[model samples]
Target: MRLLNNLTVRVLIAITLGILTGYLFPETAAKLKPIGDLFINLIKMVIAPIIFLTIVLGISNMGDLKKVGRVGGKALLYFEIVTTGALAIGLLLANLIRPGDGVQTAAVKGGDISKYTEQGAGMDWTEFFLHIVPSNAIKAFAEGDILQVLVFSILFGVGLTRMGELGKPLILTFERLSKVFFNILSVVMILAPLGAFGGMAFTIGKYGLSTLLPLAKLMGTVYATMFLFVFVILNLILRYYKISLWAVLKFIKEELLIVLGTSSSESALPQIMEKLETLGCSRSVVGLVVPAGYSFNLDGTTIYLVMATVFLAQVFGVDLTLGQELTIIGILMVTSKGAAGVTGSGFIVLASTLTAIKVIPVEGLALLLGVDRFMSEARSITNIIGNTVATIFIANNEGEFDRAKYNRVLNQEAKNELADYKY
Candidate 1:
């Protein structure tokens, strides 16, 4: 009974119940989607404001312009290097395993991929960069455009910094407002179990467990690759920094479970930011790196893009030469970055990558449509872990991380909680 009071234990039980309900009574479970949607909406409601406040506050407090530039540069560099490795690993594993081999393409159910294809077609790198500079900051917030909000926040913080004494009061006010939103978040998070339950129910009820049969190999391969990336690749990176990846994962197990049930990384974004800050990353570094990582550093999505593309090629019996495979990697490096940390954006990015390569038939995506939702948990989980590791690495590199605080939090010696909760 005492264990039931713990949020993590409750969420875990909710997930189990959701899975069983989804399997036993799929129709009723499908209707439960609203509960999940409401929880996610509540979380989303606070995201834009929290991000804006954190970035503005982080930058204003730093007081060093060059450090910001250096951090941004290092972050971008790290994103490219890490995601590139992800792409390469995905391609390598897909080739070695040949998950698509011997599958009959004609049997696969084709989804309405036209919408994704159209969205992908409109993705222009130049326009993506230009879109970051929100002409109307208010509109950006209203639309929940994270990158745009980030731009606005950075500029606002820089401008506030320039004002010196004039900025102090405003900074203090922003800090207070930030606290308010976090308090709101604490209340919102109490509904996480319901959100997890609804999300899992909708996924299983809509898709059903039987969908896994046809594409089980593909699903298995993707999951194995992600597990390898997290445990092997990410572990080595953390070990270099003298941190245990398993310990970090255990520390944030609740967030991972929520992401698993919800199948959307965005559902846990605000909490992740808060947790990372508690883990000794400077707010500024957490602010800049984690959000930007969402946009640019999608290690799992990148892996999925490569594997899915190759899987489609093998399914259709289109032999990809060494050069053509390299081309796929090149195209994925660009298109994969366009994949937001949302649920279905990965399929769109995969569609666009195939269109760019023009080697594999886009219709081959039909083979994956049924199981995409099932694979999404893996993608979102990997993405969240990647961003967390990036934040810790960049923070440590910039000397902005507090090792003592991290140890205290991880060792259960200190509790990072909000005491003044207001309704």
Candidate 2:
């Protein structure tokens, strides 16, 4: 019964059942997409409010404007360096593996790439920056615009901090309200199994497993590259700060599973923030870093964008010069940031990058239409892990992390696992 009640176990079971259902009853499983969509919608309803409150509380509680600036600066710098490396690594691996080589482009079906191309072409860096500051805060929340809410939250929190004693009652009220929303989140998470089930079912049913056969090589390369990026590159980053990568992974296993099942990292955003606090990251760091990381620190997405670009170049027999490859990296560094809060952003960003480079045919995107869903799980999982690591690293660097609390939490987790094992 305890095993049955375990969320991780239940989610695992749900994924298996979902896959089986999708494979066996493709039409019915495809219809189950709404179940997953509804669950995501339920999570989304709480997301804006939670982000607003958390950022407000974190900044107000910190009481140091300079520290906030320092934290944000450090996070942005870290995001740039790490994501650049991810882009380089993806390019390197794509060249080495040649996942797109010897592909019969004639045999593969291409989809309508016009809308994505249009979105990509229309994406403007200046407008993206301006969009961060919501003209109307309420509108930002209503639309679930994360970056807009983030900007508003920071400004509100700063104002609250400056107000000092005048803000005490409001702080208390905010704290209480935050607790209430989290309680609501706890209730909502009970439906995660259903969401995971439906998401997996729909993906398998609609795409079908056979869609993977032709693109299996590309899929394999992507998964392999991500695995190395996590265990090797990310592990080294943690080791530099004397943190245990394995322990951190163990701590957030549930969030990782949720991301894996849903193929959406945002699904686990709020829960991961709460868990990071429990694992000893300060509220201020978690607040400032996690949301921003979602936008700027997309290591997984960066890798995919580069790899896919190179893969297409190979498929179309377009030999990119060394200078052009560098340009691809530079352009992606900017376009990839546009992914924040955008649905189907991976393709949109890719389309924009291709348009900018003018070497790879944008039509090649159609070839990936079938398998992008399958690869999304890898991207989402890596992204969440990357963000969690960023929060922990930044917290420790700023002396905001509580080592005692971290050790205590890990010890308790170990004890619980041991007890469950003995059961």
Candidate 3:
């Protein structure tokens, strides 16, 4: 029972064991890739509904229906500040470390191009944004169109607010339903370590050590940047708002653990939503801000995209020239936002970016592909911090956050204050 409670420890062990298995027996690990895919499918199965339920409930519960606009402004503002800092850090790292200059990628030229080429067509910028609005909401879920699901959730929530007293029963029902879905997500999270292990094993088996290479440089830069963003940057942000970063983390410990293992921030959404609302953030603020954040506020993915593209270009002896670097940023700005909040989204956005730049060989993606699973942990962690901060900051500006409630609910003595609250 104690071991089950220590999700972080279990996840660490899983990652360690996975690396060992892949290192000792690459072929077996490679063959076991489907296990990783199955794990991803399992989590993805719950995400759309989780997003919808949380957003709808979160919005419906706002004390006043009109606060949504103030919430949106502050939330978007918060996202911009945090994400810009992320982008700057990524750029700074890329410039300083020159992650690409050292090595020669011998096998990069020979991977099967057929697998990537076919998947990349018709993936233009216009088509990407267009896909955000679903032709049919149900079909969107079936197809994993997260943005569309988000759009539907927001509209539904707004509809609820507009209906006033007539919608109370339905709103109450959705609020309960969101709680039920979150309970289900908690059960699913028990598999996180298994998912992480399988995914890491597949990564190692596919790429091997030769693929990721002298990890200290690139990995260190990314990990360091992520650490600074959360600890240094977000710590300041939280402090400015008279909140405790430690307390916020303590509150979301379970969700943080899930993101660490799954490497998919989206997987942690329901839990984050539940925890935030419990922390005194108005539901409407959380609803609009969080889903929109998933689409518009991808600080982690964007930073990684910038750093990785530069790293690849530098490694291949290609000069990005000042103009091209900006071009890369411009491309990333759009593509990373287009990324849905799901596992493997970073890779898809990276693929899109790679396709756009024509600077590095798409084959370079194959290089990172090997270590991508490990890297996902970093991206996921950054995303978690970015969103959590965004949610709170927005709530503060709109007067939607009950600072007094935050203090009370987050106080150690008030541990179960929200235990009786409706979902």
Identify the leading candidate in terms of TM-score.
2
Q: Which residue ranges in model 1 land beyond 4 Å of their true spot?
A: 341-343, 413-423
Q: What global local distance difference test value does model 1 have?
A: 0.88
Give the higher-TM-score candidate: 2 or 3.
2
Best by lDDT: 2
* Backbone clash numbers for all candidates listed: 0, 0, 3
Q: Could you give candidate 1's per-residue lDDT for residues 363-393 as a string of tens digits? A: 7777888899899899999999999999999
Model 2 agreement with the true structure over 258-336: per-residue lDDT tens digits: 7877888889999999999999999999999998899899888999999999999999999989999999999999988
Q: In model 2, where do residues sit more than 4 Å from their true spots?
A: none
Clashing pairs in 3: 58-283, 100-314, 100-315
Give candidates' CA RMSD values in order.
3.6, 0.9, 4.5
Off by over 4 Å in 3: 1-9, 23-28, 31-39, 63-65, 107-110, 117-121, 214-216, 341-344, 408-410, 413-423
Q: What is the lDDT of residue 17 in candidate 3?
A: 79
Ten residues in sequence with the least summed lDDT for candidate 2: 104-113
**TM per prediction:** 0.95, 0.99, 0.86
Q: Rank the candidates by TM-score, best first.
A: 2, 1, 3
